[model samples]
Target: MASTLVSIAGYHVTEEIYNSSRTLVYRGYRETDHKPVVIKLLKNPYPSFSELLSFRNQYTIAKNLNLPLIIQTYSLEPYQNGYALVMEDFGGI
Candidate 1:
């Protein structure tokens, strides 16, 4: 099921937390720093232009937030033919 994304070079996905038609969310960590991270990736490796735009919009909104309780977004990365939204993982989702 396109699980090729589980072990990318900079991140290691420990477990998948959610799956939907549009996205895949995983609990993972940054390889170099061993920092826990949440990865939200587009389900399709090659999504349509509109889908890509929506995904980017999600990242933009998340990264701009300054709320203390909301986990912070670290980066929006190109991965596995799609994009992965990396965020701070507070252990529970």
Candidate 2:
């Protein structure tokens, strides 16, 4: 989608891992820390308001979680017309 043409500050999108009408997940790295991270962004061409809210709520809950079993959320930022969720990368094991 249009997100492919955009870039997220402090992160380099190495490859796209998943894409759907609601979200896009990318294999990326944090520039400042040089750590691998997974970047999840809301797909462009805006989704419904309810969907957007759901996405935000999910991220909010993820950010607050402290369970060892769950991947920790790094940060969230405003993307093109949506939001981006950054989490620890867990690929290529």
Candidate 3:
């Protein structure tokens, strides 16, 4: 995602929390409810099929775990040319 991005759909991006060669993590809140969320996005504008699969797999696995220690998986939102993995923000930096 571009550094200038301020929001995504119903999310108001507050600040970018993490960045790596493969992903961009942002701290944001839902505009509708004001609940905190972490938005994980693919770094590549057009990710490969494998990368997409990994994102889906991770979300599926985490969502099914049903463990208290695991952060909640809110959604897999479509964005630009890829997707965003939205999760419960545990206030970690």
Candidate 4:
């Protein structure tokens, strides 16, 4: 299996609590500020190419629909099993 490296400069993945469906919680730091962010990771088990595409598309649609209530995506990267989405840091905001 190929591994995907997610590079977040000022953040670290939290080992405490995580939800399999909705979020990848992380502890982030910038200057003197310590923050938490929930990154939405694209998930699929034994997914074919088409399945992966479906997940991607559905995620896009869901993200578009929930734009106002939630934070916007800051970046996206390919992961080992799926894709990693970097969302807006909303710790202080």
> Which has the greatest lDDT?
3
lDDT of 1 at 50: 95
Worst 10 residues of 3 by lDDT: 1-10
Give the CA lDDT, 0 to 100, for residue 42 in model 4: 45
lDDT string, candidate 1, 1-93, tens digits: 655447666998888899889888999899999999999988887899998899889889988999998789999998867788999999896
Better of 3 and 4 by lDDT: 3
Total clashes, candidate 3?
0
Cα displacement (Å) at residue 14, model 1: 0.9
lDDT of each: 0.87, 0.81, 0.90, 0.53
* Residue-by-residue lDDT tens digits, candidate 2, 1-93: 555534888788888888777677889799998999988887765767887788789889998999998998988787866788888887742
TM-score of 4: 0.47
Compared with the true structure, the alpha-carbon lDDT of candidate 1 equals 0.87
The segments of candidate 3 whose C-alpha lies over 4 angstroms from its true place after superposition are 1-3
The residue-by-residue lDDT of candidate 4 on 2-74, one tens digit each, is: 5343345454654323446633444343323554554555445355777567757755765676557767655
lDDT of 3 by residue, 1-93 (tens): 556654589999988889899999999898899999999999999999999999999889988887899899999999888889999999988
Give TM per candidate: 0.88, 0.83, 0.92, 0.47
| Candidate 4, pairs of clashing residues | none
1 or 4, greater by lDDT = 1
